[model samples]
Target chain A: MSAAPVLCFDLGGTRMRAALLAPDGTRLAAVEAPTPAREGVGAVLDGLCALALRCRDTGVAPQAAGLCAPGPLDAPGGRMLAPPTLLGWRDVPVSALLGERLGLPVLLENDANAAAVGEQLYGAGQGAGSLVFVTVSTGIGGGVIVDGHVLRGRGGLAGEIGHMKIAEHSTDCACGAQGCFEALASGTALGWRAARVMRARKDGTPPPSGRDVIEAARRGERLARRLVAEHGRWLGRGFANLLHLYAPDVLVMGGGLANGFDLLEPAIRAEIARSAMPSYRETPLLSAALGDAAGLVGMAHIVRQSLPDLGRERKLG
Target chain B: MSAAPVLCFDLGGTRMRAALLAPDGTRLAAVEAPTPAREGVGAVLDGLCALALRCRDTGVAPQAAGLCAPGPLDAPGGRMLAPPTLLGWRDVPVSALLGERLGLPVLLENDANAAAVGEQLYGAGQGAGSLVFVTVSTGIGGGVIVDGHVLRGRGGLAGEIGHMKIAEHSTDCACGAQGCFEALASGTALGWRAARVMRARKDGTPPPSGRDVIEAARRGERLARRLVAEHGRWLGRGFANLLHLYAPDVLVMGGGLANGFDLLEPAIRAEIARSAMPSYRETPLLSAALGDAAGLVGMAHIVRQSLPDLGRERKLG
Candidate 1:
């Protein structure tokens, strides 16, 4: 008999998504709800349990669950430690709380790390021995996979590539550091740069969103194109650093900014070619294939791996 | 019965040093010879074998050998791929050639990587689960140890930290890149910067070597002190990047410039504390304990691990 499905959750500050995935990683059912982040930890935990139950009630009883959320988190200990987007939540035992409510084992992972595992196992990075997965959204975030395992360094914080200092001097990051990669190249950074440019042009237009800039560039607006190119150049600089450090089989780009990967690929490639050592220049850079589903799929795999006995019990029954 | 000793070699452009190390990593006997690098691969290989035999003849027989040399190298394939320091040599199968001569199984690793393993297993980084080892010599190079195994990324070039671009604009590196860690922070870079300063002052003093600058700084010369501080600042920036990316248990410093580690430590620590995220700020920065013997000790361990059967055979005999 085939193994039972595993429940997976991608809990973001803005939304909470849950899915029941078949053993082969097919999403059999899913549910979504707005996160009660502003309503405190108790509300958030209760809401997650409700969402998970709604997905579990879809006629396929998941044997285990996995949760992927923003960090700084203790993945091994299953605790959240002050994720920026989730206001006022601190040291919450997310895995334990949700697990007790559902009476199943729940493994926890960083969202970007889940995406990396997802891509490596089922997306653009399939068959790769090692990869670097980067997500450029409100803030740049990433995960590193080495020899098929997520490189969770001391304190499970190994893949904080977004905070890597890319320039000697530049804008400040929310982390209070100057010249961080996220500060220079994230979607938020791109929009802020575009807004500054528009303001300097003495036009009465309101500040554009990151997506607005990408859309403008798609429509052949010269200013937007220039801004996007500059964004790609910063990303290339950061990617070159990643290549030098990891030399992964591939670099998988995801997140909202990656929607403009086609527009950004040329500049990114050109800068990496110019900045990276020749040996590292040939590493493939590709767009992530799993999209929003990556975290869910990755979580499902993590759950199965962590609770193999549950899958065996289901098969035996 | 105790395990047999392993022969180890640290092959550099300037010297070839060989040693017989007891199973516990104690150096039993050693021999050194100048590398005939300019005379080409055949001459260098012959010199290495002669040195190895001399070290072996010192009353203990080694069952296998490990060699740590400058890279770009294919460590698993045991081939050197166009190392900059080794003149006129490319893709030489040094391990196969040496193993054939000595009648022993041989393992090869990049020099920095070997040092990293050595530090992690038996030196300053002893007991650390993960660490980054950096050598500041004529060039900057590094190795990453993740979960007790060296992180040899695609093509075995994972830890080329020296070539990591630290600045968006700066001096040129030998690798044809601008603003690399090596170009900014290596002993060679420090010397070059000092020489430029001296020339601009129109002083008739011949260009100072990197060692000269360090010695001058030791004596509290204001100009040399300032230069060394600048060098430390650059190293700090590069190290902050490493900390953010790897969050290693510790960072071990080695190579020629590390001799001045006491003087440089303050600036290096200041930069990292100022730049790295709070969680990573407490990682201990240490001077390499085994000194020049780190490579040999590391290679000895590698030899034992790679050829466990050899150790068993020696024990049985």
Candidate 2:
């Protein structure tokens, strides 16, 4: 028989995903929904409660919920405070509200922190004593895990690696910082570079998205390849900076770039090998093993570990 | 009488310092000696033993010895694993040897790590929940502190912040990496920049050291002020990377250049203010209160915490 489940939720800008996980982190069932962000907080909360309630049908009542959303959260207060991704989200009492709605205990975690915890507990970061999980997506974000616990910096803003000024970049990032690694090498930056290349093709040529650029590069298109290479180099520089700064045992690369690991791994590895100190050169760079489910899985694991009283909660009849 | 003491020693390439510390981290009697580095391992060990033994006459058999040395240490095994600054030393079983000689246990820590520990305990970092101690001396080094513990990375090499590739640089660092923060902004780099300016001698200007340049800047030398300003800007870039990377509660600047904190702080603050995320903009950057004594005090603090049994040993008999 499968073990009792843990509730997990990941709230993104446009979507909300809820899942049930067995003791060892296997997904029992999952439910997804549009975030209803434009309709305001109450609608979003209602949607989340409905999605979580969907997981109750597997004859398993999760003891506690691990609610992960974009952050700059007041974890002690169980609130999300002004995260940019979710407009109008300020001082959200996420855990408490969800706990009352679901009639279960709740633990709130920053999405990146949850992902790192998940990787440390059940994915590529398993057995790694110290790890840093970096996701190079629409924007760069990360979780710093050391000795099996996520390091929640002073305000839980510790591992914002993408915003680090790793080099001189002419472009400005959405974060109001110029030359951030995110501005130089993130998926958004890749699309920006692709658009620059496509700008001259005024004869009804559509501007390529980040995914289109990656596909073109895979097809060996010269301009796309150049853009991808530049992205890799910038990523390599960012990786080197992370290595020197944290010197984690393993660096797990997540986000969309992980899907194209084959194309970017070489330049990233070469840059780190040649540039980081000798002691940091051997840090294994691995792809995120749990893929898109990392946040859901990680949030569950975090709730299980952090809320030990969860075991005392009722199981669904 | 003061509370029991903690024995402390800081070993450098040029000198060795040993001191006895009261429980509150106040310095009692202290002694200094040449490092005996040229005499190889045996002589160096003997010198350290003699210095530590000097503290014994205080009618106080200290709890345990905290030995600070340049590293990539095997702190668990208590050994130094070939730090570049310390020539011809490798695989030295420091803690065990010192423990055997002193008849008390020993904790061997990287110098920067020890300094960080000391600061967290009693210096500028007092009451700080998390701190990152950065030393910009002949070489750049740093120690990350979180939750009152020094972050000893996977292999005790975690806090090598100087080796970070935070910006572009033309010179090769001692660590074999080009454009490392150390290569771009450290005292050694400052000297390199100063020498280049001095080399275009239409006048018989003597090539100055890094200190000489700083002194000249203080004396209002136009060229010297420019050099210092450039160095400060690079340091600012490195600071911005660190602020984003670690997000520590306090950033303590130490080492020789810290003597000129006035010259560097504004630029560093400006850089971080302009580039770092808004959440990280207010990170408190402070001068290292313990100064040259930081390494000694930090080492002792680390030992006291790491080896609880040391408290069971002699407490100033």
Candidate 3:
């Protein structure tokens, strides 16, 4: 293994995160910048290149670099095939472009898959033998780790948990599907519910934001509590499906909503217990340990595996 | 690899299957018999031994023997642990018992995992990088093949697909769960639906078996057709969930209902297309190529991996 740290970048729709990770999985330095994603793919690429160069100048000219972002993607080909959240980006050759710009081999992975790997290697799933990581964010995304290797399925595009049609009549998804888990459960869906409840309130209650709803639930807001419980039920239902299909040793929850896992976990666990096969009832579900850093760290881990010849590969640029 | 033939057995609750397989993947002989399962675990063991002795008497004593049955099991320790379908079979040291009786090493595998391994080596999943297998029979069972290995999860009980919650208000399952995929869409569930519809019929139609429902649907009986369609919808929804979670290269469907797959395929595929992530529309759902032979063949396949010293380890007993 290279002793030099791996530079990791997590590219989101609104934020660009950068980190330098040591060979022993330690984070040395990290920073974040606004991602002007609306400026299109070119601007995003430029931002990524600048971020890597900044990391290099700060004494972490990485042996390699890892990038994590949303999909529909070609992970093996290192291309983004028009992720729904990122507009005007289609078949972007991310890895090649970064490799050329930074003069270093770059590995790209689906953000959720990266986070799952990071958690499996260093977070809540550290001791678990097999795991399924679900991130219930604006939408749901999943990463499945079995026997230490992620199940990338056929084309490195595995683990898209949100689009699964768990509900027969919930709502239509942007993906043109009805009753998807994400359509029914995600943070965005929760926010939509909260807004609708506020609109229908005869007592003239103020509309709560997703964060506000979570906070109010904690503070004993009845409507907020009911809505969040509904979210938890949806989450639990999805988790039950996963437990049945994978029988994972652990189910780890990550992403923004996981911050209030204490509120969500009980309902999720109850659903899993009530829905999963008896033999699978013992599988533990835990909150992610790395928090926001998971994407960067997971990308770093993927980089080591994907770009094995990082330092030794003949540099073209 | 050993050139000697391996004896493989698939011990189901109702039937016993055996085969002699050469190392080159050719079957020398195949045999079947009634399982005698109702007589309890000891009778099952004696029946298995009798089948092995019959195989030996007919020609070659196997270099090793592999047995595939239901979960929960200890594959590493070769013990059967309280499988619901196998009454009174609790922590039976099957491998030890079989080895003692046959004077050869014995290997045990969960039937689903065995089927998955079978597919990877010789069935529809051959040459595929990853595959997920689901058997929609009286119950739902899942097996995952990632890269070239069967994903046994933490302890050999990974891939339990049938119990995933597909319906929010599905009936209680024998495993003491409600809303499970099995409770909503298994062959048994389909039968139940047919019976309920028949009871509600003004024309006084007889209640249908699962097979009868399939035949009636094929003949275009409206109620039967509707029942099949509903079952297909559930199957599709469940597959959509599985697709999002695993994104497998290919999904192989097996079990008794697979015979009517032609009747079920179109609706299932259509529902999946309607419910899945847009990018995953092209993922294939296929009928298993190995048929009922998968269990027996898979046993031989897993034995070759788990007990490397199968032919070499001779027992005087």
User: What is each candidate's DockQ, to 2 decimals?
Assistant: 0.76, 0.68, 0.69
Model 2 chain A TM-score equals 0.92
Model 3 docking grade: medium
What tier of docking accuracy does candidate 2 attain?
A: medium
Kindly give the stretch of ten consecutive residues in candidate 2 chain A with the minimal lDDT sum: A308-317
Q: Which candidate should be chosen as best, given lDDT against the real structure?
A: 1
State which candidate has the highest TM-score. 1
Segments of candidate 1 deviating more than 4 angstroms:
A308-317, B308-317
Q: Could you give the fnat of all candidates in order?
A: 0.77, 0.78, 0.80
- Estimate the TM-score of every prediction: 0.95, 0.90, 0.94
lDDT of 2: 0.81
Q: Best DockQ goes to which candidate?
A: 1
User: Over the stretch B1-317, how does candidate 3's per-residue lDDT look in tens digits?
Assistant: 56678898898877888888888668888778898877887788888888777777767756778888888789888899887777788889998888787777888888988888787779988888788889888888888887777877767767777766666677778778676778887888899998887677655866667888898888898877888888898888888777777778889898888877888888899988877767676888899889888877777877877555554444323
- In Å, residue A231's CA in model 1 sits off its true spot by 1.4
Model 1 C-alpha lDDT per residue in residues B1-317, reported as the tens digit of each score: 22888889999988889999998888899889888879988898889888877886787887778899998899888898888998887888887788778887778899999989999999999999999999998999999999999998898989899988888766779899888999999999989999999999998999987888999999999999999999899999899889889889999999999888988899999999888888889999999998888999888887777785644644564
The deviation in Å at residue B56 for candidate 1 is 2.7
lDDT of 3 by residue, A61-101 (tens): 67788888988888878898888778798999998988788
Native interface contact recovery, model 3 = 0.80
